[model samples]
Target: IQMLPMLVVVCLIPTVLSHAIPTGDKQQLQWISKTEALHTLETAVRNDKINCVVCSTIVQGIRQLIEEEQVEEEIDEFLNKACVTLDLAAPYICEALINEYAVEIYFVLERVIFTPDELCGIFVD
Candidate 1:
């Protein structure tokens, strides 16, 4: 029975090793292409006409907070403050989007916020 377990593990080793291979040139190229596309989309979002002053400021703050590698608590605090500021400016915009778009607003918000990973997904999909 011990030998059976060892044999099973030996068989699985090759499978695991095969999957562990580093991304090859083709995969690397694809990733680089996607990354470039993501950057283009981010630039477009930054220049997009839909951005209000309050929304733009919050988006900028989020980008800055992420770039600065702040702690999770600080990021949450910053976002809370941003929301409060936004509430004072135009409270109904977010509500309108949520009420109209519902689940689909995630895609819109992802574009508006423009994080690299999220943008990559938005661009890829």
Candidate 2:
């Protein structure tokens, strides 16, 4: 078929390089600097190629800030809006979550900056 060559070129590259390079290399998460990370967010928000690994790396950096309490105001809001909303709902032909979905829950506690003095509890009286 005429289309056979085109498909071969696309498929063959990754298939060959993948075998040559260690699988761990592909899995390794590279740390990007703060400015670069922000740029990634801007690009990822619109781009089709953004995946869980990319999102996770950025989220981890933000989480680190939340842990350190270094930048209370700026980091918390960003964490809630961005990381917490990640959708790991699955892939085509298999609608299952491969990525563990916990950014939002963790962000709620860690990035709140401050909470109310009064805690509410439900009591069946």
Candidate 3:
């Protein structure tokens, strides 16, 4: 549905920023908890310098989390909070979108298995 693109972007934000952040910033990130790290990356992606490296990192991170079976509940909680915090849509709409598309999103993420660089290349280039 129309909300799918938004979902993809939300999911990919952390991965992309992981690549875009400077080495010093990346080092700083290593010490943070995963949730804090994700928030930091989310903040970074709001900047204007997004590129292929960022995109690749984002895709790779997402795939890794999914593969590790650590994504479902966290993704749900993260997206729900992000939806409200970012104010990308109305609360009801955001909830509806998450409820409707989470399964399909997970299915695609699990099945595709494209290399981070490859997927990022497609989007970033």
Candidate 4:
């Protein structure tokens, strides 16, 4: 009876090890698009939920989805969608806003090393 438990344990080791080991390629992380980020921001703005906590969460989420090299393009795409979806201003005004602030936005997003919380703290408060 003493060897029976040991035998059972030895028999199960291979089965557990096979399942634990990887058999194929590693999976990649899926990221959201600019449109989704815009939609989320718009919803937060419309619902009066644009506080530091909310902003930090949004920024962190976007940061994870986008790479440093893609910051400028993502900002442009996000702002364009926001202008149309939120209807905050006319097309010219939107264009001007993008022209005026896109570089600053890109600088903050790509060049600055601030964490999402720190970034939102500067802007939100």
What TM-score does candidate 2 get on C-alpha atoms?
A: 0.34
Listing every candidate in turn, what is its Cα RMSD in Å to the true structure after a full C-alpha superposition? 20.9, 18.7, 5.8, 21.7
lDDT of 3 by residue, 47-102 (tens): 53446665555565666566567657677666666666655568787777777877
lDDT tens readout by residue for model 2, 1-125: 42222111111111111112111233784543445544554465445344444433433443354455544334333332333233211132011111222344344536544311111111000
- In Å, residue 63's CA in model 4 sits off its true spot by 3.2
Query: Which ten-residue region of model 3 has the weakest summed lDDT?
Result: 15-24
Q: Pick the candidate with the highest TM-score.
A: 3
TM accuracy, model 4: 0.55
Give the true-structure RMSD of model 3.
Answer: 5.8
lDDT of each: 0.31, 0.31, 0.57, 0.47
User: lDDT per residue, candidate 1, 1-125, as tens digits?
Assistant: 32321111111211111112112243563222323423332343345422232233323333433345544444333333322332322334433333344233223433555543443343222
> What is the lDDT, from 0 to 100, of the residue 106 in candidate 1?
29
Which candidate, 3 or 4, would have the higher TM-score against the true structure?
3
Task: Per model, state how many residue pairs clash.
Answer: 0, 0, 3, 0
Best by lDDT: 3
Off by over 4 Å in 2: 1-31, 77-104, 107-125
Candidate 4, 11-43: lDDT as tens digits: 121121111211222385454444454555566
